[model samples]
Target: MVEALTTTIQTASLILAGWCLVSTFRDRPMLVPHLVAVGVLWLLVIAQAVVSAVLMSGGEGPAQTLMFVSYLVFIVLIPPACAVWGFVERSRWGPAVIAFACLILPVMLVRLEQIWNPAGV
Candidate 1:
């Protein structure tokens, strides 16, 4: 179960992304979708950070350690920063910004998987 949290993080990110997509199509308030998607993204990213810290402390490889730490920094900052920007914009593009973050997360997670196990690569 060394890489189990990666799966959890991926699932949560996908769910938030799906919610953002659905809300975008339904024409919901920009903030609603933004908050919902960003909220979940934030939670999962934080969890990932914690998990990464634990794994690194447990003596994972240098590449895996560094990758998770980098993703932690990105994941922690992006969503909240997007939330603030989205709030200020007050337009459809608000949620669109969140959707963009969702796009970034999957790539990061896949990289995270690689980080957890470069031997698999």
Candidate 2:
């Protein structure tokens, strides 16, 4: 993954996580704005996945291609799954769930980056 894209993803994830956290603390359930933010984040993730796949296929990415792909697939599924769960729960915990999921994204992305560029610390 490119450094700039990684930074963007990380920043976005942090922002989303913060939003979710604030919503949860304010006793808000999953709302339209939250869903929209998640949607945008999902699009960003998909774009990154496509770019990474292309890079990998061109022999420009990590040698651990299978692991990278697995992470990509997992990352892509997180937001929607959490969204559904949050919607179903319909409580402050709903936003809490999203908060946790968003928190996971940054860690997952960092792991994906490490898999893609194993040489870096």
Candidate 3:
């Protein structure tokens, strides 16, 4: 995994979470802008996944390969799933759902990093 890319993704996720939380507090439903932001985030995540896959295929893989891959898959799926949920719900809670997902995303990415390169390895 690329450390810089991971950090970028984490930062982006946190920022998006904050934005969604504000939207939730403002009693706003998920809108096109929010969906677009998520779409951008999703693209970033996909880029990271592709890079990781390439590196792994080239034998620069993580020790816990299965776990890493599973996390990777889930991480990739998260944004879109939550986006759909938010879009369909049509309420302030829609942003809340996205906010929750965004918050969880960073933690999951951190775990993915740990799996990719355990400390002192």
Candidate 4:
């Protein structure tokens, strides 16, 4: 669990959330550019997940290994799932759903970080 990568992911997700929220307020559907941004974000998450998985395989994993792996899987899945939902809906609510997902992503990443490196460890 790299702190820098975690911070970068959190920052990017928050920025995306704000952008999606703005689009939602403007009554815009999920456009190609928005989807591209989501795709980029998803790639970043995938990279992080891959790195974490490698580290875990190397025997450098979190204390609660099962929980951390589950969170990792969930985190990797969220963006594309919501992106598809947004693309399918074709309305302002589409971006709203993305915005909501983006907002949740950062919080989940933070929790993942905590699980990866507990306070006393």
Best by lDDT: 3
lDDT of 1: 0.69
Candidate 2 is scored at a TM of 0.94
What tens-digit string does per-residue lDDT give for candidate 2 at 36-119? 888888888888888888887787988877888899999999989998898898989998888888889889999998988888
Positional deviation of residue 16's Cα in model 4 after best superposition, in angstroms: 0.7
Candidates arranged by TM-score, highest first: 3, 4, 2, 1
Which segments of candidate 1 are over 4 A away from where they belong?
none
Task: Supply candidate 2's per-residue lDDT for 25.
Answer: 91
Better of 1 and 3 by TM-score: 3
Native-to-model Cα distance after best TM-score fit, residue 87 in candidate 4, in Å: 0.5
C-alpha lDDT (0 to 100) for residue 7 of candidate 3: 89
Q: What is the TM-score of each candidate against the true structure?
A: 0.78, 0.94, 0.97, 0.96
Model 3 lDDT tens row, 2-121: 889988998999999999999999999999999999999999999999999999999997889999999999999999999999999999999998889999988998898888889734
Lowest summed lDDT over 10 consecutive residues: which window, candidate 4? 112-121
lDDT of each: 0.69, 0.86, 0.93, 0.92
* Model with the higher lDDT, candidate 1 or 2: 2
lDDT of 4 by residue, 36-65 (tens): 999999999999999999999999989899
- In model 1, the Cα lDDT at residue 12 comes to 71
CA RMSD for every model? 2.5, 1.0, 1.1, 1.2
Give candidate 3 misplaced runs (Cα > 4 Å): none
RMSD in angstroms, candidate 2?
A: 1.0
Please report, as a residue range, the 10-residue window in candidate 3 with the lowest summed lDDT: 112-121
lDDT of candidate 2 at residue 102, scale 0 to 100: 85
Which residue runs does candidate 4 get wrong by more than 4 Å? none
